[model samples]
Target: MSETAPAASPSAVPLIRCRGLERAYGTASARTVALAGVDLDVVKGERIAMVGPSGSGKSTLLHLIGAMDAPDKGGVVVAGRDLARFDDAAAARFRREEIGFVFQFFNLVPTLSSLDNVALPARLAGKGASEAQAAAQKLLDRVGLGNRAADFPDALSGGQQQRVAVARALVNEPQIVLADEPTGALDRRTGEEILALLGEVVRERGATLLMATHSDAAVSIATRLLSVEDGRITEDRALTPITAPIKEHA
Candidate 1:
């Protein structure tokens, strides 16, 4: 009988781990590979940025880590659960309960007020409406959107809406926050403000953040900077002075 390799030691296990991860679409003649043999480890409370240009698999990697998508090969383990181990239904629940997401487009519902939008996740998690709304209010206030809580998405500027999105992401108190090009749609000044808010909140909560962006300013907020090109990471550097100003925004 053959024996499997022993599991990695506890001290070596990462909060997020991707090993030989790959994602491909279509078959032989039309196969498009988004990722190829990627390996990475994100420790608890670590803030890392994945920087890459269009079609470089940065978003795909983020999705895979967030349990929104599965890998075609290899594995992605998040919060100690491997992506390959979960069925679709389980993965969806895991996403709702364990991962917080902030997208560039700010996916808030048009009909809901900013407060309601942030509270939706808590409601989904089974909190009473009043309790959830109160929690939502606290988060919104922390993000500097307390006065805009009753405003709808259409009434807010891009940055304000994104701040609401950030607040919404924290509603569930997820262990890992995944942001994909969160500042892509905002003006430089507004984007900086949103990024600063995100950094502050993540630090205060001591949650791990893995954000993917093409902006140098975005990379500057990260404690560790990783560069991806041609669907592969070419460099990974830990910035000594992460607080240094990179791009002057606002």
Candidate 2:
């Protein structure tokens, strides 16, 4: 028998691609297929909105794409790296370095000040305390929360806390921002403001944004609108170009 050379691993090209993604929970007899054969291609700097009714799999798709959860079958590729290739440790590092998340609940620690909360991610990534503080300060200022930096989560209003969460999401300067119902916690007025801020940040940083939302107003800023229903994508539409934020009406 002749000896053969080893095959090379897959190339690490930078883009988000999902192949026949399917996810289900619970036993086979009582399984819930949250996602079914979902295929997605998200390139750098693309603004995408995943819109669906409640329980329509929007959040599940976001979590899978963000590497927060894995599909029962199929693979998730981000920045040309297959997520399935990583071990638990590597996956955590990848998420820390490349994925930024904003949740609807604005999960800031109640005891921490806004500045400290925003700076926590960087700190966890081994940044020096002072460096994290400076970066957090700048981010909070960008989000118009500079004056509230010393305030704790309970002291700030819903919108302010969400703004702090936005700052925290950007603290690490991740390549992709995955947001799940980021505007859901706020009233219409405040939600519009946060959406506008998100639009501005996405444009300014040239970062890819994939948001899961049901609100029509949330989809207004998206460059592409994707509708998922019955565990499949039913529509993908490119809307009018979005350059400026739609003003919020009180």
Candidate 3:
């Protein structure tokens, strides 16, 4: 697979920024730290893959960046707006307009057709049904799922459902896409396909991508790799063209 170019110089304004971020769960007796003083900066158009063992703060960091969850300390700033400053309504608006998310479980509405599931985000943002459906159709085609648009989630294979999820993530033309273990549920071959599609579409749309995964094949496509452990980033480095070989599932 071809590698994406590096992002702009360090002087350029970062699209995502996290500063002294800290997150924890439970009470004092049973407290568990998810993130501890984690900081990061991502420029526009960067494909960043975060890899780590289970419960290593990868999901926590992604949540903070996506504003799905707030940090107990510090702040996350995306496109110049401090996430910590958003009120409930503003946060909702920001999520709808500025950020897109993909999850391990396809998370499609079981009752909605693939096209409708893709179009739902735009529709909820007050877009006309016709306009949203049109956009969703175009995305479905881009993901090679145009013919499956009318099928419900239960009717499609796992790979097909994931493709729909990807289309849904891009329907709103978000500036940032946060994926939490997006390929975790698939077999290796399907996972590679999903990762490749994500890299291609995200690059084509000029959207920054931050993906959390355990698969090295997934990391191979990233422009930068970050490894987190014990609630902190242990490695942050750029990947060369020959980062890692893509392996097939047995």
TM-score against native, each model: 0.91, 0.92, 0.93
Pairs with backbone N, CA or C atoms under 3 Å apart (clashes), candidate 3: none
lDDT of 3 by residue, 214-240 (tens): 888866678899999989999888775
lDDT of 2 by residue, 1-250 (tens): 3344211113424378888989888898998889988987776777888888788888998888877888889999887788888888988888888888999999999989999999999998999999999999999999999999899999989999989999998999999999999999898889888988887787788888999986777666777889999788988776664686666454
- lDDT string, candidate 1, 1-250, tens digits: 3354223344755889899889987899999989987898888777888887788899889988988888888898887787888998888888888889999999999999999999999999899999999999999999878999999999999989999999999988898999999999998788887887787788778888999987767665777888888778888877642553333343
User: Of 1 and 2, which scores higher on TM-score?
Assistant: 2
Distance from true location, Cα of 111 in model 2, Å? 1.4
Best by TM-score: 3
Q: Is candidate 2 or candidate 3 better by lDDT?
A: 3
